[model samples]
Target: MTLDPKEPVLRVVPGPTDINANGHIFGGWVLSQMDIAAGIVASRRANGSVATVAIDTMEFLAPIHLRDVISVYAQVERVGRTSMGIRIEVVASRDRGREEVKVTSGLFTFVAIDADAKPRPVDAPE
Candidate 1:
């Protein structure tokens, strides 16, 4: 799938410290970004706090360089009683946004939580 041009949930540029021995951005760094973006979407949909339950699927389509600006797009793809499936896509903008490349994609599951930190119905009134 192509990267959506709409507003991204998060955008960041990796630094030299985030690079790995391969001279590319660390995979874990991108994963963490994805998780953070997905959490934002999940929490918005749930109208409260949410916790990541699982990473259902993840794919690395391309490498990210330090000069690349990463844009993360996340949305709630599915909703259950107390859980939500978030779809996240990461695009790397290089050459000052002249080129956009799909670097990673992931599907994450999150559960809505109450003040007690226990799972709660996602549709419950806020």
Candidate 2:
């Protein structure tokens, strides 16, 4: 099941290179997708540059298979002075969208940055 009902931040399809020798998609590939989705949400919220600070938590619930369409969902869970906690979830749609399974969930921290790559307030004006 998808973690959220709203639209996904990113949808991606895995290629042959993404598959592992075990015939399942690589966990690192799924993690990259989650990070990308979280970065997108964090950047939009910060309204400027942002950098990933940390991954607070992560859980891999199901194995992703080849030909599964990955839907990454992310949102701002909390906003700090210079950082935001992004909640990210990944769902894999299989069998041509007939079945969907929650593949992974994670929480990431992102800090807003200025031109110098220093921390900046999240509410800073445009």
Candidate 3:
């Protein structure tokens, strides 16, 4: 997938401890980052608490290196009565931002919740 040029919701660099035996950043680390980014967009759209209900699709396009700067971009793709779909994309900037690669992409579903932790209408005002 093409990396979007828009500003990312989050950016982070992985440390040595995040690397796997294969010398690449662990998949779980990037997955968590995607979840965090998606949650931010989901919560904003829901205007309150939100929880991840499903990951519709996830693709690991390339390996992430330790020195790479990871940027996570997320947007609300669809909205229902009580759930929304978030599209998340991750890019890695290597060699001090000279090289950018699309590392991961995912579609996550989140349910809007109320104080009681029950699903609520996504369009409900806060």
Candidate 4:
């Protein structure tokens, strides 16, 4: 569930504070990062305010320890009139030591919103 460089998206690295007491990255922390990444893709495609609607089939494959430098990549996989589906992958590596391993991944659905906070049609990218 990792993303190749060909995908149009951005990468994010989490910091030490992102980890939890269990010494592994918290599931909530990971989901937040994915949401942020997905929001970037969603906003660009929607061209307006966007909110997370749903997350599907999220699976945590490996434990992400403190300072593991997790990377998140996201892309718009599908677009509807009012909503867009984004695919996000969370990967972690030990600074070129261990190869990048996918720690978790999921699909997030977002709905475009207007200034009034009402669902609106997502504009296709130019």
Cα-based TM-score, every candidate: 0.94, 0.94, 0.94, 0.83
lDDT, candidate 2, 19-126, per-residue tens: 999999999999889999999888888988999989999999999998899999898899999999999989999999999999999999999999999999999943
Please list the Cα RMSD from the true structure of every candidate, rounded to 1 decimal place: 3.5, 3.4, 3.6, 3.8
lDDT tens per residue, model 3, 1-126: 323438898999999999999999999999999999999889988888899999999999999999999999998889999999999999999999999999999999999999888899999964
lDDT of 2: 0.91
What is the C-alpha local distance difference test score of each model? 0.92, 0.91, 0.92, 0.79
**Between 2 and 4, whose lDDT is larger?**
2
Q: How many clashing residue pairs, candidate 2?
A: 0
- Winner on lDDT between 2 and 3 is 3
Report backbone clashes per prediction. Answer: 0, 0, 0, 0
Give the 10-residue window scoring lowest on summed lDDT in candidate 4.
1-10
Tens digit of per-residue lDDT, candidate 4, span 1-23: 44353553545556777778877
Model 3, TM vs. native: 0.94
- Residues 21-97 of candidate 1: C-alpha lDDT, one tens digit per residue: 99999999999999999988888888889999999999999999999999999877899999999999999999998
